[model samples]
Target chain A: MTVSSDTSMIHAVGLRKSFGSKSGETVEAVCGIDVDVRRGESFGFLGPNGAGKSSTMRMIAAVSPISGGSLRILGMDPATQGPQIRARIGVCPQEDTLDTELNVRDNLYIYGRYFGLPRAEVRSRTDELLEFVQLTEKAKAKVEDLSGGMKRRLTIARSLINKPDLLLLDEPTTGLDPQARHVVWDRLFRLKQQGVTLVLTTHYMDEAEQLCDRLVVMDKGVIAAEGSPLELIRAYSTREVVELRFGIGEHEEIAPKVEDLAERVEVLPDRLLLYSSDGEETLAKVHERGLDPIASLVRRSTLEDVFLRLTGRTLVD
Target chain B: MSSTADDGSGALPGTLIRATWVTDYWLTVYKRTWKGTVISSFVTPLLYIVAMGVLLGGFIKGDPAKLEGATSYLSFVAPGMVAAQAMTTVFGEVTYPVMGMIKWHRTYFGMIATPLGIPEVILAHLGFVLFRVATVCAVFLLVMTPFGVFESLGGVVIAFFAQLLIGMAFAVPIYAFTVGLKDESAFALVFRLGMIPMFLFSGAFFPVSNLDAPMEAFAKVTPLWHGVDLTRMLTVGNIDGPMVLVHVVYLSALVVLGWFWAVRRLTRRLTD
Candidate 1:
């Protein structure tokens, strides 16, 4: 199978993945979906857990076989040319698979050697990667001793050892703290600046907004929406959201009173989100209705609101 | 740092020599912990020879013909110890380390993400296991020299090769089993039921011929029995041409079969 060289970095048409359980039942993890990721673009799969983001990432990484449909990575068929495709792409799996037995520096060096990199080149690259991840001081420390953020950085550094043209990150900062997430985000932004085409899966709408040039919102094994973060928000949500929290079960009662205050009012369990062009105006109307709330805030709409609008559920829940 | 544009046509060098990098990774890891393993590889085997071969051989007053025609029991059991030690060493290498690489540390996942494929990963790990078996056998032979177990230097050299074959024969299948396992419970069962019986009944401590009809026949079918017999023949200079051929073929077949299953299983597990 020959693929055109000038094609997108990742191109898929109606791709699918189904897993067979021991009880002879089939679970369709990813039902047919189409996606295209161009060169130097940070593409994202944004969804909640079990939304087939990981399944799709695995197929693109050439580690998992696609059950159906056509897929090409680096202009090569992943099914027939897994090694060749893998040689040019970096995969940072969701979980940290760092070698705990080796120190931080050796982890990078050994992984580089696996790619048949020259010894001197691997040595120098290991040094540079340690610095790139801001782990130069911890280069000699064992991987098990590093914090979660450091391990994620080392994993990213290990992925870049071969200087891949396309990088795949599966939830790059899932379990990280806010500060750690920003650190990882900064490093990823730098990689994108270097023109590495990145394809990442993230449930964090903020991560998708901060890093992705284009993204698809997936739910229940299919794409519900796709566009740039701004496009997604503009299409599915209002410019701003007025968040009003009443007493525990008072949101349902309060939502009706504020119904005409915005274009739409979504009554969630703990809070009522009012979708409107002007959040402050919506909040003023909510107060004018004589309905009091425990707390109220006006903020610009984000991808989270887009996800909620499209799926009728929050990104995390 | 170099921003060389990838043309999407460059291929990885998927050569055998590149697989040695996995072995190199293990060797580098071993360098840090070799001191801890030295005692088990060398001293423990030495202690076994002294305790079982020397101290216990003192009590077994038997005719040379009955004790495999050897003049002393120490010489009789020394080669068996070499084969047993090889089995133990290779078993250790293939079990927890293999499982750890797959499930715990996920080192194999990390390797497959690179240009290294499943076959290369399996071969490289087996290569490292062979190195470990060689080291353990060398140390065991060196320790045995003080006890005058060597009939001839060439005989001892052949015994070393026999130990290597025995180790590989056992390492590959156990590696396959290890990769399939989700937990370490089966490993304990393997040690208790499989390894212990083979160590005791496979002519490692005494001639299997001394057992009853059914038991002796059972021992003959075991891979370690072939290993022990081959090493004993080489160490004792009682080289039997046809029997030697039989032992080598049996061990070689096991190694080949084990390799086939291991590679297939590991590829399935690592890829999908």
Candidate 2:
């Protein structure tokens, strides 16, 4: 079949994926979600572990089969044109799928060859990707010698050897330190600026805010909310949050006292969160009501706060 | 970006091109580590010929009628030793290496993420297995020349191809078993249950006809005996055309069937 003439890099309608568990039952990992990732836009799937983020990414990478519904990657049906779609897309999987047998440079070279690129072209692109990922110096080293962050960069570099139209990163910086994470984010930002349509999965709200132009916050195999970070915050959360830490075991009791002081009151085990348009005003009213908190802080609402509003749970454990 | 079109029909030539790239990767790996396998590939074959044919044959005085239709025990054992060496080397190639690709190193998973299909991956691996068998058996033939193992060079040449065919027969099925493994210990079970039994009773050192009827019949069922007897037949300059045909067809059938089974298991594991 001819490639579909679509403007979007990825278009999915009611995408679904399921696995047969050991108990002889089918467990749905991604239950019918529509997704449209347009050309040159950075989109993300923001979710905690077990949210089906990796499963969806695998299907889009054309490495996993779809159990139900439809998925078109880069305007070609993955079921029929998996190799064709994968040829045009770069994928940095959640797991480190790098070849341990080959040294750093050969990983990129072999991956490019898998897409049927010429040897000289793969060699030149290998050098270019090593430079891009700041791994030129380590090109001759074994993959085992590289640290976790360095391995992640090499995987990213290997994915791009084909110069794909679309780039998919699953948990790109999940296990990296803050400084190393920023380095990855910076490189990704550069790729986005170069007009590579990027799709990534991350549970880190800051990462979503830093890299994604738009995203879907997924939970329990479904999309809970979808928007830009600011738009999600503005729609689901107040302008600010006042975090109040009270004396031992007083949070639940004091939560009722501040019920009328904000748009919403959430009582955690250690603290009470007052969601309000004006955090200082909410704190002042809490004091006027004789509710003495041990400590307090006013902060601008973030995607975490938005996630809390939509899912009634925190983003990370 | 370059055009992302499927190669016409995505069969034969397209599969071959991609499979060759995969073979190239293995070739690169082999270039690095082949030096380390010199013991098994070259030196080990030499030791086996000396120990089994020359050293051990010095003792046996089989019935003058025939030592499995050979005048000397060395002549009978030489061909079997070569065939058995091919089996051992191919077993090494397809077992842990296959498991490592599927599970530990995740190299196959990485390839699947790219445009390489599972069929290409399988074909490329078995191609490398073929190469491994060729190199080991070639070294074996060179080692055997001084021992006067072959009646003629042309006959030895025919025996060499027979060795290759038998090597594939062993490799394809063993690879099928390796792909379905999760734990490394399962390999030990295969060694104890399948490899060792077949290696010992495949008439490499003695005739299987000496065994009881049940055991002899069982030896005939294993592919290695066909390899050993056929290689021996050609090596001794004896023409049993019908029996040779039977051996070729049987080993070839195993290679084809085991290949499909391997492809199916790999596709299921990697794709799902």
Which portions of model 1 miss their true places by more than 4 Å? A1-3, B1-15
TM-scores of chain A across the candidates, in order, are: 0.97, 0.96
TM agreement with the true structure for every prediction:
0.94, 0.96
Give lDDT tens digits, candidate 2, residues A24-79: 99998999999999888999999878889999998999888899888888778888
Every candidate's DockQ is 0.43, 0.59
lDDT of 1: 0.87
Q: Write the per-residue lDDT of candidate 1 for residues B53-137, one digit (tens) a residue.
A: 9999999987788766566899999999899999999888898888888888887888888766777788888888898899999
Chain B TM-score per candidate, please. Answer: 0.94, 0.96
Best by DockQ: 2
Q: Which residue window of length 10 is worst by lDDT in model 1 chain A?
A: A1-10
lDDT of 2 by residue, B1-272 (tens): 66433462356777777677675588788888889988888888888888888998999888845566676898889998899888888888888989888888888988988778888898889888898889889889998899887899999999888888999999988888888877689888878888788889999989998899999999999899999989988998887889999999999999999989998888878877
| Distance from true location, Cα of A110 in model 2, Å | 2.3
lDDT of 2 at A70: 88
> What residue pairs clash in candidate 2, if any at all?
none
* Model 2 misplaced regions, further than 4 Å: A1-3, A247-250, B4-9, B64-66
